[model samples]
Every structure is written in C-alpha cells, then in structure tokens.
Target chain A: MKRTASPSFAIYTPDSSLRQPLRLVGAMFRDLSSGRELAWRLAVRDISAQYRQAALGLLWAFALPVANALIWLFANASGVVLIRDTEMPYPNYVFTGTMLWAIFLEAANAPLQLTTAAKPMLAKINFPREAIIVSGIYQTLFNAAIKVVVLLPALLFLGVQPSGYLFLLPVAVMTLVFAGTAVGLFLTPVGLLYTDIGKTFPLAMQFMMYLTPVVFPIPAQGIAATIFRINPVTPLIQTARAWLTGSLGTDLVAFGLVNLGTVLVLFLMWVIYRAAMPILIEKMSAS
Target chain B: MSDPLIKVENVSKKFCRSLKRSLWYGMQDLGSELLGRRHGDNSQLRTDEFWAVRDVNFELGRGECLGLIGRNGAGKTTLLRMLNGLIKPDTGRIEMRGRVGALIALGAGFNPVLTGRENVYINAAVLGLTKAETGRHFDEIVAFAELEAAIDSPVQTYSSGMTVRLGFAIATTLQPEILILDEVLAVGDANFRHKCYHRINKLMTDAAVILVSHNMDAIAQTASSLALMDGGAMTVFHEPVEGIAAYHDANAQRQATTSDGGTTHQCYAPVVAAEVRILPAEVGYQGQLTVEAEITCDADLPEILISFTATNAYEQAVMCWHSSRHPSPLGLCKGRQLLRFSVAPLLLDNGSYHWNFKITRRGSLEHVVWLTRHGPLVVKSRHRTLGNIPYLPDASQCEHRMLTSP
Candidate 1:
C-alpha cells in the first residue's frame, strides 16, 4: 500500500520531513525550555546514584583531581619531567590548571556518558532525548561545584593577587566548556555506533592535553611550541590561566577568535545532534 | 468511536541480520538526514536484511484496549516501539495525539545505585511528569508497589520482582494518555499480575492501551479488540476469541513447516505416498483416538509399523503407540490400502498437542514415510474452567479433610 495520512494525525517515516533551517533553530530553543526541568531531575538522579554506594561519597569528585594534581607536582619537583618555571607556586598553578581542565573534560565526556546511561531508556521510552544531554551537562557542572570549594582556598594559600580582568574568567571558562562539548556532541553519533570511539576517546583527550597549555605554559620556540601555538585549545586554557593568576597574556585576540569559533562549531553540532540522534538511537537499540 | 488517540498507518520497519551492515546502514541513514535527503526505499529488502514489521495498520481510540498476540520475532515489539516514537516507521507513519508511556522493557530505566523512591521520581519525569507532580504522587506510587519499607533501599538490593513492581507502579500511576505494554506482566508474580490487570483495566477507562503478550487468556480477557501478527504483517480481529484462535492456527502451521534437517535413517523400500487424518477435530478427556492412514506401496510388505507420537505444548512426548507393540500384528497389502486403529483414551493433559504419524518397517532402520507434525488436537479438560491441566492430581477428591479437631 501507498503512504496515507489524515489531516488530524502527524506521520512519521524513515525519511524526516524537510524542515527549513530557521524552523530547526526555533525548535532547538523550544526543546531547551521543555527539556530543562527534566534535565534537572535527571541530574539529581545521577548525582544521588553516583555516590549512593560509595564510602567516600561526593569527596571523590574533589579527590580525583586533587590526587592527579599532587602526582604532577611531585613529578615536577623531583625534576622527572621538568615543567617550565611559572611566577606562582608550581603546585597551586598545577591545581588551578587541573581544575579548569577537569571542567573541560567533563563537558567533553558529557555526550558519551549521557548516551551510554540512556541506552536502555532510548530503546523503550520516547521522552525528550535532549533532556539526557542537558542532564549530563548539569551533572558535570554539579561536580565542578565541589572543585570551586577547593579553588578559593588554594588561591588564598598561594598568595596570588586577582587580575583586574578577573570578571572575564567566566567567559574564559565558558569557552573551554563550549569547545570541549562541541567536539563531544560531534562524536556522539559515531560513539554510539562504534564503541572504538568510547574506548579510544580518553586516550585521545590525554594526548591532546599535552598539545594544549594545560599543565605548562606554551613553549617559546621549538616544533612542539609551534604545534601548541596552532592548537585552538591552547588560547582558551592560557586565557583562563592568565585570568586566574593576574597575568594577562598577549593572546587575548586569539582567545576571542577561538571562543567565536567554538560558538559556531557548537551551533553546527547541535543541529547535527538534532538531525542524527533519533536515527542513531533507533539503530543502536535494534542492533 | 471518537477520533483515535493513536493512529498507526501502514507502519513497517526493517532490520539487518549482520552487525556490520546494520552499522553501515545507520551511518548512511544519519548522513541522509544531515543532507536533508529523503531515505531510500526501505521496503526493498537488502542483502542480510529483512522487514521486521511490514505493512501493519491499526488505530487505538480513547477508552479502548487493543491486544497484540504473536510468537517471538513476529514484530509486535517493533510496532509498539514505533508507536512509542522510540523508532520511526520505515515505510509509513504512527501518529499519537497524547503523551505515550511504554513499558516495553521492565526496569529498563532503573539505575541500580539509586533508591527505589529516587528511581520512581526519575522514571516519572522520564514519562513527562514534573518534579511537583512526582512529589504529589510519590506516596501513592510506593503504596501501590507495596514497597513502603524497602523504598529507601537502593534498587540493586531489591529483587527482580520488586523492580518490576516499582516500574509498573510508576508507569500506571502517571496516567499517560496512551499506554503501551509489551510482555511486562510475565515477569511479576500472580498477585502483582492481577493488580496490573486491574490497573490496566482502570487505565483503559480514560486512556487507550496496546498490549503485546503471549498469554492467550490475558489477551482474551483484557482486549476490546485483538490483532494477529505473523511474519511482520498484522490482521486485526473484531472478536478477541477469533484472533486468539487464528493465532493458534498460525502457530500450528508454523510448527508443521519447520525443517527437521536431513534424516539419519533412510527407507530402502519403494513407497509411493502416505496420508493421515484424525477422526474427530476435537477430543475430550478420556476420548478414544481413531487415526486413519492410507499408504500406497509398490511391493507387498510383510508388516509395516504405523506409529503416532503425541507431544504436549512443551514438546515433551506424552504418549507413543505403535502397531507392532499391539497384541496382534497386521500386514499391509501390495497396493493402496486404508488402515484404521482405535486406541484407548490417551488420558493426556488438557492442552493443545501435536500428533506425529510415521510409517516404518518392523525392527529395521528402513522407513516408509514420516509426517513430523500431523495436526493439533484440542483436548478438553474435565474441569470446564481449567485449561492446560497436565494430568489429574493424585490428591484425594474430597472437598474437605479434617486434619485436627478442637
């Protein structure tokens, strides 16, 4: 039989009805509002469940990054890796940098974590899937909230003066979040299909961190320095570091350009997610 | 009837057999969507792929209950998933006007580390309930699940039955406009199943329900109308009983045609053909079975063993009788001959059974022919209300026995 539809009922098919780009953009705004409440609920669910069985509970959120920071501090002190000199105490610098990077890591990992946890629901339930994405991000931010507790005290202990452009820190941190999440959202469809993406992503992120100015300042000159300069994330990380330590870098223009590029990439990825998520969910579940 | 709350029109879905091709197809589908290109003809079967659901059509109006009865791989789950909007139809459309809640997989959304109460709230929100709504109904849900004491415990600590009870309670209490249940009732105990049926009946007063289950009695009891699904296509029946009977008929056909593979023993004798027919279509408890067979042989045979084996619903052989085991043996004529045998009442269980008829040479591996699945025998129970009563219990027939006196 041929396709048939009544005026009262909306039809669904493998082929999505062609919608204008403007309509899709409008739908995203509408979806965000509708999905926000559920996202908060899911975030609460995730946070409670994450620590329900653990003895240390939410402390692990702070503990994990602090532990990594200490390991790096010792390595630099013993001259194991020889991180470049900085004006601030190296431990505090490493801790602050780690904190910012942790937020970026959370944002980058949000899409994969959300889709994996929601796979069963995706197969059976038909609720707003955007809620999963929003919840994942909210959970990331919630974990980062605990990091702020340590951050304020560490800055005081290190005796570092605040930058006059300290208010711009939010803008810098947001750029890191957006850039990381844009890359993650772009990988979500691929990750759901080929689990190789999930297994290899953490290793890839670890490698990319070396290219960014996460643990050390960008080198002055060398092949590695050139690679770091070309890296988009280097400006974002350095900008946040510069804002936190009261040392404004000369790469403010590059940082602004990177933020602008991150926004555009995020918008493109959001559009791709809207178009591709349902198809990916369907295929993943059926397989 | 008022306009259907859920309208499903000629919905079809395709699935690939190989994992590699399935992933490739997924990528291609996603690429097409990004490019705003229409999907290619999915109705045309590709290599290593077939339609899981094909040209299925149905409508569910408010206050209506529709039952989907089929065997495994019959596409009922696929159809329900499409209606729930978990997936889109490959060829057609499914449109619903109201919020749809599906219990396609029980405990599917539960997080093991979350408390039962917490899981219920999240599950309610997943079904579109707000936080305030979930809070308002939290006690009611826990009460319905009878998990008051254990509601605070992590879901991982609860048994499978408790998990399903919680899942069911949340879905039903949410009072969705359209409810889709798929084999969920099979997991819980009898008491919970009864409660579920009661809740579903109450839900159908306002919302439409689509139920897919293997239990014929449940379908017959609950469905306002029924749909039979076989090999992906759907045929709706006006009467639930008729739909159930058609399901059994289709199952019988499926049973008879399934390949048994190459035979280990072959008959050297030249045999033309064989036919078997049951004397009566329906047999009651302790009723005589008269099996008639007509076999044509090229040469006269000394004695041919005519045997029939009756197997229960579980495919367990309940009875085996052969002409050679009889007190007096019989011989077949040279040409076509009709033979009839009257045996004692089988006294087997009261359920559907398959009677397999076979012809073989006496005391030899050589065989004439074999009909693996001859036909179904609907055996009636002495207790008219009971179905599938295996054997008469060895208990005393007395209604009451005094074990102790005050």
Candidate 2:
C-alpha cells in the first residue's frame, strides 16, 4: 500500500525536548489542538460519571462554599470572632469570597487530579498526553461555570444589585482560573511522583486562603495586611469579589500583571510537564 | 515489501531495583530534561540499576507481523512500550511511521462507574478516534462485543469477559496502520477467542503488526517472523517455526536444569530407570507407530496401571493409552520390565510428539511414578488436513461420490 499523504510519524530518543525549542512548541500546539475533542469527551464522561452516583447531584458543587460561608457567618454572628466592617453585608462578602475561592481551588487541583486519575491510561496509550491537561481545564471551567451561576443568583438574593461590570466578572473569574491552573500544572509532575505534594497541597491552600481576603477583609496596617498585599491571590480574589459585588475596588493593574506572569509560568510548566512525563511514566510503570 | 514502517536501532533502557532509588533517579532525569541537557553517558549503570531492554534492533514493513516471544521480565513489554511511544529508550532511537495502535491493556482508560457505551467512547478517544468516528462505529462495537442488551449498564456491573470483549472490539475496529498486541487474545471464551483471531488475521494484511505472546499457537498462526528475547537481549528468527522450536528448546533446557533432582513424589514404587524407543523414528500417516519402554522398578506394585500419552509441539495431548482400559491390567514387579504400546494407524498430522508415562495404583489411583520423555517422534503426512486429527479410513472401506458439479 502506498503511504498516505502527510503520514503521521514520530521519533523517540534520549535527547531532551528542550534541545529543539521550536519543534517542541510546535508539537505542543499541535497536540493541544488535536487534543481538544478528546478533552471534551473525557470531561463529559467525568462530569456524567461524577454526578451520576451522587445523591445530591449539582448541589455538591455548592456544598463546600456554602458550608464555608456558614461557618464564617456563625463565627461573626456569634461574637466568636470580630471582623472589620465591609462595604457590603458580611454575608454577601463572605459568600462571594468563598465561592470565588472554591473556583480557584478547583482550578488549581484539576490538573493533578485528572492526570493522577489518568496515569494508567497514560502509561499504556500513546495518544496526545496534552489531552489530560485540556480535560482538566474543561472540567475546571465546567465547575467554575456552576459556581458563577450560583453566585450571581445568591448575590441578588443578598440585596446586591447587578452592576454594569457584571460582564467583567467572567474575566476576573478566568484570571483566577488561569493563575490557579498554572500553579496546578506546575506542581502536577512532582505531585504525581510523590504523595507529599498531594497531601500538603490542600493544607497550603487553606493557609493561603487565610492570607488572602477570602472570608475576612484585609487588615489595616499590620503584618497580616502586608502578607495580604503581597500574596498574588489577593488581587485575583479582590478583583473577582469586587466585580461580583459591583464595587469599584478592583485592582486592575495587579490583576493584569499577575495574569501575564501566570501565562508565562503556565507555558513553561507545560513544557516541563511534556518533558517529564515519559520519565515519570517509565518510573511509574517500573514500580 | 514497502519501506519499513517501524525502525528501531540500538534501543536500550535501564531500571532501578530499589523503589526509593528509582524515584530519586526519576527526579534526576526529570531535572536534566527540564534543563535541556542530554542524557550524559547513560550506557553505564549506576547503583542498583540494571538494563531491562538492551541493544535491541529490528525493522518491520507493511504487511508483516513480528512475533515477540520471551519469558517473563525478558523486556518484551518494555520494548513494546518504547515502540508505542509510551516511554523513551535511554540509549537509542525509534522511528515509527503511520498511526500506531497498542492493545497494551484492554479497557485501559475505562471508568467502571461509567456505562459501557460511555467507556467505549472514552476508550476510542484515548486511542485517537474522534467522537464522530466512534459514533459511526458504536453500533458495530456493541454488536461485536455482544453487549447490545447491557450497553447502558455501568462497566463495573459487567463481567470481566464482557469488559474485555468491549475493549477488544473498540481497539480492533480502529484499524491502525501499526498494531501492537500484548497478550490481549489470552482472554474470553473459546468462541470469542476464535473471533478475535479472525479479526486479527484480517487486520494483519495491511498493517505492520507486532504481537507479544507466550502462546506458541498464536505466534505460529499469525507471525511471519519471530524474535526471541532472553535476559534483555533479542535474537531474530526469519522463520516462525524455527523461533517456536528455539523457544521450546530453551524452555526444555531450563526445565531440565531446574529439575535436576527429579520430580518424583514419594518413596513408594519408583521407576529407577526407563528408556523409550520408537519403532520407526519417522512414521507416515496410517502407518504402525509403536512406543516401547524398558522400565526398572525398585519396588513391587502388583496393581499398578501404566498410561502413555503423546503430546504435540503445542503441548496439547493428542493421544493417550491406558493399561487399565485394556482387557487386563498391567502390574510392575521388583525388576526390569518391557512394555510396548502401538497404534496400527496413527492419524496425527505432521509434527513432533513427546511421550508422557504415568504409573498409578489401580484402585486408589495414587501416582506410583511419572516421567516425561522428550523424544519428539516425527510424524510426516503427504495429505494435509485442516485440523490436528486426520481421518484416514481403510482403502476398501472408503468411497467418495460427487453429487454436484461446480
């Protein structure tokens, strides 16, 4: 049989992919495009399977943020802790904060979770590995969409009027996703190799939430305020919350800067992931 | 043959013995990869490291199947993984052209919580088929797997056989240009297995196929050439029969060395010495084939039954004879005894056959002595038949008449 026009072929060698920067990037882009359909299929499969067995179904997506908001509301209302005054009602403030935080957390955890789940497939099949990462992004977007839909209705229920900047809310939420997915993709290689990263990741995210303006307002002139100002998540969360609540307290410049840095880091980590996967798969299969 | 579709050159891979060290080395390799530094001098092994596959080279063109036969841990899987591009070789290069499909693990990406229909789509996607493509083939896959009734049921609810059937159906329907099958046919019932072989034979005509299996029958049926891998090294055989023979010879040698102390069960009535002689070394069809055995018994067993079994090259017992089934049972005294077993018309096809002798107590059926003699008595036939056993009627008794004209 004659060879097909533009027959697909691949060469595997010990030479580092980094040695061929242009080709590596080209292949990455190619795989990214080709992997889109697969990503959608996997995402659909995962989402269907995930909710199929759940008794509460989509409510589970709201469970974490709602529970978080209630705990803080209880703490504030019961005088167990004193929180500073905010421009909006404390309930609105904490609820929006917790919802956006959940989006960020889910985005950050998606890559590792999906990749770890697909380890067996990755070791056996030779399809574009980038599909897993794309699938993770798809799932995160699906989850973030759910939270945003819930947040918009809840904001109106809490007496906050929809503002003209409501369209910008998606942008802010996507920036948060970008930053979170970047961190997650960066940690995925090591996280897959070691349980230490997967174990300590949630704890670190929890601690980071405290440093960010998640539930409580940023403190007034203290070490806590300095940490909040310096934390990259601070601008993302503050911007998202401000846009959601229709407030003019958005940190546009810092958000832009953080997103720019995030794109660069995300791309770099993607390359690292592509380079490290074969080695990781080899080791994983050996064990 | 057309230009080679798969070319592998001096490919080798190393593995670490200790898990901890393996992880550590993995990290180091990742670091080097990230730094854009080529693997420096990986030909030498570090501490606790050994070569899993070493210096293996072969090229395969279209319409050829290479049967890779090896013992466990001989690196057949490692080599296949490299060829499939799941992992990279540490010291060599592999060039694979066309779409390569690997049935390394059936139902590899299957999620048990999902229905069979859902998993089929997901598995097809993972194997590089678009959703539209999968949709087109969905009904055929379901029909082939015979899961039309339970296609909507979760895969976890399906039996292992059902799942494997679904997996095999989806994997084979893609019709890739290069197919790698690793013991995937070693499952399912006899009927399904036959169907799978038929499908594989159809796929082999246009694809460059690499099959890794321990079953000699499978290799003999599918492969045009063979590769014998032992201890990370490979020896290529142009002929499938020669490769099967080498594999059997290697296995026999290994068994012989391992069983140096003998496989005798208890100290009861043991056969001290035995010799088996075939009357005619090369027997033709419908000829008299006789097996005579001279036995030296250490103890008297008055009611022992002796049985002789002839096994073919595929390790299938083709024929057996038992003294207990005869008009009178045979016994062993405390001395040398000669026993002769004969078949007036051997109906076995052309192949090599080995003999197995067993002596058991008549009533209790307790094994008195058991021995396997690898005589490999040759059977030659001018008339070739499709199956193992051929029907050879007496010349005067057999008559044929054509009822219809073509």
Candidate 3:
C-alpha cells in the first residue's frame, strides 16, 4: 500500500456568482461544444444505421429532393389541363428552393430534438454542450452535400448552363445551414426546460413554412414580402434559385447582406444557448 | 499543501411545486399571510418552495469514501449530484478537485437498438472515458458482466437481469477519481452482489465513493463516515452503524406517532399495514429445542401464510418448509398485532439459512400483504442433525430410475 499525497484544504473561493443566466449560458456552451464531439461519435452510429441495410444505399439522401422536384414537375404539367398556369418551368423553380430548404430543414431540425437526448451524456460525463448541436449540424451538412451533388446532374439534364451566379450557391447554402442551426441551438434551453418547445416544434415549423419564401414568389415592391425577406432563409433560397436558373436577381447585394446578417443572429443565439445550456442542464439532471 | 479533493459549503437546494402542496398553506395567503410572504414568484412557492438545506458544509479529503445515509427524498442524491456538478444549488457552491465520475443513471445511455459493445463505448465516452481507454477496459468489463460472447448482441435481446448487469459493469469500470453512486448496486444475485461489494471496496483505494442506498446493512458494511440527511439538512453524520441507528430511530419514531390512514401510501389489494412484529416464541418451553426468527412485517386483516426453511451456507435447502396458514376472514383486525414463529426440535444440519417471510391471502393464496427476509440462521446441528429430522409418512415409498444398461 502506498500513500501518494496528503490532503491539503485550500480556501480558494470560486467565482461562481456570475449573473445566473450568463453563468447558465456559459455552461450551456461548454456542454454543447463538448457534447458536440460526443454527439459526433453517436451520429456516426446514427448515420450508418440509417443507411446500412437500405436497398438504395446513399441514394436515400437525394431521394427526397428528387421526389420533390418531380412533384413540382408533375404539378406544373397538370396545371395547363386544370386551367391553372405557370410561365417558367416550375420543376426548376422548386428544385432551386428544395436544395436550400432541404439543408435548412435538416440542420434546424436535428438540434431541435433530444435536448433530453443528450441527458445521458450530460449526466454521465462533463463535456461542451455544442458537441451535440454541432453533431446535428454535421449530419445535416452530410445530407446537404448529397443534395448539392444531386443538383449538378439535374442541372445538366435540364439543359441549364452554369451562370456566374452559380458560384453564389455555396455561400447562400452556408447561411441557411448556419442560421437554421442557430435557431435550433437557441431553442435548446427552452426545449430542455419545458419540453413543450420540443413537442410543439413541428407545429411551429409548419407555421414558419408559410413565412419563408419557399413555395411562392415575393415581389420586390411588396411590404409584406420584404418582411419575409428578413427571414434568414429568404435570401438563401432566393440566391440558390437565381444561381441554378442562370438568372440573377436585382437584389444580390441585399441577399448576400441578409445571408451575412444571419451569422450575427446565429452567433448571438449561440452565446445565449451556450450561457443558458449548463444551468438548465444542471436543473434537468438534478435528482 | 495539497488541496482536498472536494469542497461543498453551505449548499442548499429546494424544489417548488405548483400551488398544489396543501389546503393549509393557503391560509397563509390572507392579510396575516401577507406580512409573512415574500414578493412575486416566492409566493408562488408556498411553504413547499423552501425545503431548507441551509448552511450545510463539508469537504472531502482525497481518497475519502464519504457515506450519505438518508430517508427517501432526504437530499442525499441531490447532494451527490451537486458534488458531481450535475446540479448547482441555488445558494452556496461545490467544487470538485478532480475529474468527477458519477453514476446518476446506470442504464441511461444504453440504446436498445445498439449492441452491448457499442453501448459500452458510448456510455463510457459519456462517463469521460476516451476511445482508447474504453478499448483497453472493454474486454475486462464484458468478462466481469459475464456477457463475453453476448456483447455482440443488441441490448434489447438481453433480459432485464442482463441489462442491469451490463449497466452495472459499464458504470463501475470507469476509473473515477470522485465516484458518486446512487442506489445502483442495489441489484444482482447474492454471489454477484458480494463480488460487486468487493469491487467497490477495491475502487475505494483511489476514488472516494459518495454512495446513497436504502440498504442500511450495506451502508454499515461499506461506509467509513455516514451523513444522515433529514428534511433537507444533515441531521446526523457519525459512525456508519450509529447513523443507521439514527435512521431506524427516526423511522420508528415516525411510525409510532402517526395515526392517519393517509400515511400508508404503498401497498397492494385491500390489506394495509396497521401493525408489525417480531417476537421470541415458546412461552411454554425454554431451551429444550432451538429455533429462532426475528420476524418483521405489516398487515391488517391479512390472511397470512408463513413459510420457513433451513439451509446450509450454500443456500441449498437441506429440509422442507414448516408453514402455518392464517384462516380466511381471519380473527385478525385493522390494529396492531404481534405474531411469533418459534417451535421445538431444531431440525437441520449445521450452517446458515435465511428465513424468507411472506404474507399472502390464504384463500386463493394469491393476494399478498407484505413480504420480507430475515436471518442467515446458523444451525450447529453437528450431533443434532439426525435427531432433528421429522418423521416422513413414507421414506421408502419413492422409486429411483436408472439410465444404465437395462
């Protein structure tokens, strides 16, 4: 038997009293970030399990976008006989929007859930909280990459040439990805606290769909439509549409600025969740 | 000077319920109550808002296994969580000087869809074990769980016993510096239970285990110093056995004073515990023949069936049960009753046997009142074994079968 070290009591005071909310936010961030790495490990399992025995393999990722684009095409064709009209090819129009929408939907959603999903990890080990959020982000990004790759072949099949605006798709996609994720991150504390936020999230997302400019066009002069433009995803979907169609919108700068603006909002939300996440987690896990 | 491994000072935690505590707390809401009540959300708290665990203070020297003993909801688990940094008390603070490894939830991270191998790593990672650390320890954990080949199978395929085994193995294997356990070693069979106790003793060399359990016997056996939590504060912290005595004292006191039927919450069927007893039987004979059982139970109008069997230390039954059945619509009542079970002719070989006590409906033999266990009854039947055997009606009536050349 060997005694390594004798006990010495130190009276070092811990600066534990930072405004409760801020302290909570800081802890939340740490938990999320550390949790993100842990989540990455878990998501690797989730991703593999999702596609492992599927017949279509990785085609599972692109299948949604393809199905959506086909629905758009079929609807547009049926419109003439049904006495409704669309001038430009609606299939291409929906494809452009679907590309960005798919990424936003995936990224925003993955983090919105399992605030309690990370409960075991939080309770068992201490890690940064963002790890869980970022793991969700990575999973979404994986799906987004699939959607992006599928875009190229479709663009060629549609006889569309690459326009200068095509270069902007990545930038716009990045904005949607980050902005959606940030909103999801912002909801973490509330989700963990009330759980109402999680259970009711699908309903809220459905309402948000109407506000976003995915299905309909927003005329430049409309005041109501302008408000919708501020919805982070507006410019993201708009930019992707303009690029894929080889036609540039008049508000490329406004669109780019809006896309950039979401980063700040996302960052602020990140800070809030980072700060609030820990205390809420502490509350969540207290026996 | 080296710092002690943990610091918990003046930490207090309380849970506030949603205005449903009692009809009495509402009387404090009038003009008289206004002078007593605080502002805003504090009033929303009612009297239940503050489960005052105030000014509680303690520190853990490195490698100190502090035992926390308490009644249900005594803030023992709450304190353990705080030490592990799982919860922050509204007042005061707790600081751990080393990596905290706690089992807040034993099977919390196990995914039913994943194989046991996958869950072990996932759960280990959550408990701060890196990939390499988990890899090195994985085989040992699987072997310890006695699920070597079964590790590859999904956890859902395993029985509840297997699930608890795997969870216990995974949680215990992580080399925690400050280990916190909450009533998780309360499962497993007798031999495995002994094995776990030994493993826990070994772990005490490096890590300080802050263990919370309802088993006072285990607390007595394992703990060095005990902290008895009552209400929300530490009412007693002393020797392990002393703390257990205090707990029993508190429990017995609470039992004697209460008269309301509302106190009895957990029971099945129509039977309720109005009385319990343990007594020495043989009012007529002194030491002519020896048998003893320290029985304890709760029952009201219980049609009780009692069974007693003597066995060796291996728990192999050397003789059959001596049973007595309480008659139906019995001469029992809804008040205190003391029943004793001791009879002549100590009837078994030398060793220990546990008295398994159960009370059930004598009619269908289905409805149960309460059940309990007692005594590793020691039998020194060295010369008394033959004298103890009761005469069976037919010792030579049964036929033996042979699978040999017929």
- Going through the candidates in order, their DockQ values are 0.34, 0.44, 0.17
Q: Assign candidate 2 its CAPRI class.
A: acceptable
Put down candidate 1 lDDT per residue, B33-115, tens digits, no spaces. Answer: 88887654536877888888988888889988899988888888778777766676778767787666666655556788888
Q: Interface Cα RMSD per model, in Å? A: 7.2, 3.4, 10.0
State each candidate's chain A TM-score: 0.89, 0.95, 0.78
lDDT of 2 by residue, A1-287 (tens): 22121127989898999999999999899888888878888899889889998999988887899899999999999999878776678999899899999989998999999999888888887777888888877888888888889889988999988898788887887788888888998889888888899999999999999999999898888999899999999889888888888875658899889988888988988998899889889866632
Model 2 residue A90 CA deviation in Å = 1.6
Evaluate fnat for each of the predicted models and list the values in order. Answer: 0.60, 0.73, 0.14
True contacts kept of 2: 0.73
B45-108: candidate 2 lDDT, tens digit per residue: 9899999999999999999999999899999999998888878788889999888877677887
Give TM per candidate. Answer: 0.79, 0.86, 0.74
Q: Would you give me the overall lDDT of model 1? A: 0.76
What's the C-alpha lDDT at position A181 in model 2?
86
* TM (B chain), model 1: 0.68
> Residue B259 lDDT in model 3?
64
How high is the CA lDDT of each candidate model? 0.76, 0.84, 0.61
Write out the backbone clash pairs for model 1.
Answer: none
Q: How would you order the candidates by DockQ, starting with the best?
A: 2, 1, 3
